[model samples]
Target: MGWLSAGDGYEVALVEGRVAARATAGRAAGRQLKSLPKAVREHPEVDRLRRLAEWLDRHAAACVTQVDTWMVSSLPVPTGLLARVWPDEAWQSALRDLVVVGEDPQEPGFLRDATDGGELRLVNLDGETVRLSPATVTLPHPVLLPDLEDLREFAAELGVTQRVEQIHRATWLRPEGLAEKATEVREFAGGSYDSRFALAARATALGYRVSGGYASCRVRDAGRGVEASVWIGEPYWDGDTETGALSWSDENGRTLRAVEVGPVAWSEGMRMAAALHAGRTVEEGRTA
Candidate 1:
């Protein structure tokens, strides 16, 4: 952004997300100051720039969140929508380098650019840039990508770095032989925290919601909604608490048996459970 004149002999602008200043008539004219000068510290132009920077930060975060949701759900997004939003710097940063699957299905590519002319430029696994105008594209979850390892290797060679986690997001797979009638999985049970508040805080920090005594994640799988939860104790409790069994419930709140959970739901549920467990306090060789 171009600098704006704050007062006399000085101009101010947002630099690296903060208000910065430079002299206009002195020896240091046209050179950025190491810190904001007191003369313009409370200036209206500087305040406006600071607010704009803050708003831009929030906008960037929102873009990453929306893109992350689309990837996690493996939902198809309209190509036109991508092209429309591609002009936005925030959206572009979040969507770039994501693995996108178009009509071909078998040919997954790294999203490179989206043009206003309704074309998408992508770098395929074969290390070639290709243009496509598929009606829609899917930013597939890493677990659903058949050639995940290959894509990861290619991304490394291409020096790909995505602002939002897609290819490198943690994932867990449903194991074979879960008891048919098991309504909850105890795989991540018995994680202890200093207090219920601490456990709930960890869950929230990890981007899960706290409701009642459970830290939960709601996801749509196979056209149905399922909520995965791990017990974190009652919200009002301040005493020590232990992470409880992980479970899944339908949108209507009916518990689902292990065998009844869909693949995506199962994987997402396990991912949540594993994440909560990873934060459990470890005491020597025993879990605290």
Candidate 2:
């Protein structure tokens, strides 16, 4: 957004509310030394630049979290709000190319750009770009989007990577009679502090992708890959925090028999479950 200078001899440009690019302002700027002398390179100005970069990275991450929350909740966003934030590069990058549904809901389109006058330019399902002035628009869940497959293909052609989760996340309904199902790979009893986000965060830290309100990881053993998933519940941030389930399946999502699960797969699956369980809060007069 602006250029900030360190009193010594360095200046950095803040773009989109983040430190995007930097420039040296004095003699140091012109020096082409393969390596700067320790005295010059280790100056306070250099430290200032390092600190500024770190802060910028954190700010950018927070921006992403806020946008992700909006998409996950499927919140109805006002057209005016979109136009106002669209100018920020961070917001623009996250919003561009996401599938959005207007008031009609059924008629979905891919957002291509945000125009100057609170109008959204989108490519409709019929492969035509049209501008719409809806009162509110929603970034629908992938399951609710009728033309998801087509959108994925189009994205591939355009080499676009969506920052939003919808297109890439897989959705699944709990299988019929899952409670009466044959086998349980693992289960984590929820804790008081173990909100959906906390559990999902744990799963993500373990390199799993969160989808369909579940945190899942894939493991390969004996030449076959199996996915282990833990369901923390829908609207994971809300709802009862005392219950959760874990399951394992093949690539096609077929439930695997306990006997069919490899030793390593079983261990990893249990490890995830136990870790989550350990983080649970034990409340008095509560039973699982």
Candidate 3:
């Protein structure tokens, strides 16, 4: 049994060319990567890891994936790489496993001062004293990077670099909240692309403000890369889609911003839309 449960949050699973399942942690188990796109490499563990990275990278405006765990909040994800997600509580228990349990001005000074056992304080080249934590992170399982040396080799195989970084700080709109906003947006943009409106509306429910009008979502490669145009009210439209340009407008049907939404970025659009809806500044809501 996977982690999905009847009432658990939905996690999208892409197989061959279809929308495989809306899974939870338990339901996610045993779901093969038969449908994931070619951009994701084919090894069993690599496939799952890529999807998880893609999911978090695409859906959460700001998120981090390390070797052992994933963190998607304002808090920094301790540095470490792993093959699976770890339970949050284990962070404290496995402090010694961290790459750096260092102290920062942003962190709670009390917590930093509380730990005196095996803690190391060192000054950097800049002559800044920083207290390092003793925790270390370990991977749940070993992962393969057969193409680690050559960038093109890895990019050719994985369609993207196989590097994953721990997030130090990220802010995002909650997914459930975004679903609710989509409802309001659907009413705002009534047209043939009602589904797009719904999807965007859901994103709005999560707090993303729609800057561009709307465009048709073009699904390709059996659903590996979904493309579309969305309006993000900022200096410019954001999205690195390859399919084509998205068309959106206002009450006057004037073109606001037409952008390409890629399979990986579409998920990010949902998260970005949420941040916009919440009235967060573009710079403040960016993901690392």
Best by lDDT: 1
Q: Which sections of candidate 2 miss by over 4 Å?
A: 1-44, 174-201, 204-288
Considering lDDT, which of the candidate structures 1 and 2 is the better prediction for this target?
1
List the RMSD of every prediction in angstroms: 1.4, 13.4, 19.5
Q: What TM-score would candidate 3 get against the native?
A: 0.20
lDDT of each: 0.89, 0.66, 0.31
The residue-level lDDT of candidate 3 at 229 comes to: 41
Best-to-worst TM-score order:
1, 2, 3
Model 1 regions lying over 4 Å from their true place: 284-288
Clashing pairs for predicted structure model 1, backbone only = none
Tell me how candidate 1 scores on lDDT.
0.89
Q: The CA-based lDDT of model 2 is what?
A: 0.66
lDDT of 3 by residue, 1-288 (tens): 132222233333434323343433365554543343343234454446456657644433322222223211112433332112223322232322222223342221111111324444433223344555534311211111122233233234433322332221122222333342132122112112223444455445643344455323322211233333444322233432111122323334343232322222333334343333333222436652
Give the lowest summed-lDDT range of ten residues in model 2. Answer: 14-23
Query: Which numbered prediction scores highest in TM-score against the true structure?
Result: 1
- Tens-digit per-residue lDDT, 126-209, candidate 2: 778988888888886565567778878876776667876667754432334344445564345454444667666666775568
Error of 2 at 32 (Å): 7.7
